[model samples]
Target: MLTEVKNQIKVVFLSIKYSVMRELLNRFTFISNVIFMMLNNASMIIQWLVLFSLRENMGGYTFKEVLLLWGIASSTFGFSRFFFYKAFSLSSIINEGKLDSYIVQPKNILISIITSDISVSALGDLLYGYIMLVFYGLSIKSFLLFTYFIITGGIIIAAISVILNSLSFWFGNTDVIAETGNHLMTNFATYPDGIFKGIAKALLFTLIPVGISNYIPVHVIVNFDLNLFLINTTVCIFLIYFAFITFYTGLKRYSSSNLMSSKI
Candidate 1:
């Protein structure tokens, strides 16, 4: 079992490495995409700045906490896309029967499919996250904690995508649902969760899980809570397992396109 786990870890790194190499080959396009994405992400900060100047807080979040929220959201998104870009397009892949190539490979099918591509723009998001962190004032403990939250948050985001997209196996074409669900999660993640109330807030913590991805993490950062931290950790682990189980369960029903294509 240990050896199997080790092998899987190596395969993941190798897949990401090759994807990065492919992106690097088109240097100008890669650089431009990253820069443009970074600028786009940075632009939102201006709105936040203006709002903070007018009012002391939004949804109980001071400007600094809001900054951390953006940092967490962007970093979580960057981690998910940078490592598993295909997760976002799993619905399309399933509808088009693109799992054929992955089925032929010995690695984990879900991992293989999700890591097949790299997003250059995601690099910009990752960089922008760090820039926000610097603005938040860097400290060794905060940096390490932020990294931990990024990983856990990224896992939850990816797992949710997989679960939502896997519906294609049953519904034939679930592309719309997957896209809408993903967009909703991303949109909610950027805002202050405190602004939401009642059923909407309940949904974020449960069905949608944007709170787990960003809000709860931000709260933990601003004011640490052992119980909340443990809850977040447990939720991430459960979601990951749930994602794998759902994808593989649906895989049993996958209809291959049988189209000839290269794995890379």
Candidate 2:
């Protein structure tokens, strides 16, 4: 069992390593993408800055906390794109019957598929996150806590993507559902939670889950809370486990392109 786990880890690293090398073949483009993404994310801070000028706090967060909120959101997004970008394409792969190659491999199919691609621009988002953390206030405890949330948050994002896209296995072409899920995760994560009300807040904590992925983490980062931390951790575990189970379960019903016939 341990050996299989180690082998999967090795495969994941190798997949990412090769992907990085391939993208680096065009060094200029890769660097430009990263820099542009960072600049883009930095420009977004202007809106918050303008708002904070008008009032002391926006959505119960001071300017500093708001910066950290964006940082956590960006880092989570960066990590997911850099490490598991392919997870978002699960719908296309399933619908087009491209998952057959992965199924015949010895590695964990989901991990193998998800880790096979990288997003160069996401590197900027990851680095910019730490830059924002510096602005938030650098500290031994703060750094460690921030890193913890980035990882767990990234996993939550990827797991959610997998869960959404895996639905394609059962529901035929579920491209629209998966796309909406992706947008919801990215869009809602960047905002302070207090602004959401009623159904929006409820959805963040439940169906949408930006609460666990970003809001709760930002709160814990500003002021550590054991209960909230544990809750986020538990949800991360459940999402990841459910994602894998759902994908494999649905896989049993998958129809390969090789099995397709010309109707003519």
Candidate 3:
């Protein structure tokens, strides 16, 4: 059992290493992509600043708290995209029968698919998150907690994408649905949870899950609530298991194209 776990870890690291090396082949483009994304993320802070100047707080979130919210959201998104980018494109991959190469590999199909590519722009988001953390006042405890939440949040995000994209196996063409779901998750994650009410709140907590992914993490960072932390952890675990189950189950229904294409 221990050996199996170690082997999986090695596979994951090797996959990421190759993906990063491939993206870095064009060093100038990679650097520009990262910088542009960082600037784009940083630009949103100005709007938040303008809004906060007029009001004391927006939905119980002070300007600093909003910074933390962005930090967590961006970090989660960046990690998911950088390490598991294929999660976002799984539907298109499926629709085009691009699962051929992955199916022939001995590694876990989901991990292989996700780590097949890396998003250079997402490195900016990862850096932005740390910058925000510094602005929000860095402490050893807060930094450690933030790292923990980022991992859980990124896993949940990837799991959600997998679950949504896996629908293509049954629904034929679900690229649109998967894209919409991904957009909604990203949109909702950037805002404060206090702004949501009733059904919206419930939906965020359950269906879309930006609540636990972003909101609860913010709350945990701010106040360190044990219950919310545990709930977030539990939900993350469940989502990961659900993603794996859904993907493999759908794989049984996958129709592969026999096109001869080399994997990078």
| lDDT for residue 144 in candidate 3, whole number 0-100 | 94
Q: What is the lDDT of every predicted structure here?
A: 0.89, 0.91, 0.90
- Give the clashing pairs for model 2: none
* Residue 220 CA displacement from its true place in model 1, Å: 1.0
Would you list the clashing residue pairs of candidate 3? none
Clashing pairs in 1: none
The TM-score of predicted model 1 comes to 0.96
The residue-by-residue lDDT of candidate 3 on 37-64, one tens digit each, is 9999999999999999999889999999
Could you say which candidate leads in lDDT?
2
TM-score of each: 0.96, 0.96, 0.97
Q: What is the C-alpha RMSD of each candidate to the true structure, in Å?
A: 1.2, 3.3, 1.1
Could you tell me the lDDT of residue 21 within candidate 3?
A: 85
- Residue range 16-36, candidate 2, lDDT tens digits: 899888888999999999999
lDDT, candidate 2, equals 0.91
Model 2 is weakest, by summed lDDT over 10 consecutive residues, at 255-264
After superposition, the stretches of candidate 2 with alpha carbons farther than 4 Å from their true spots are 259-264
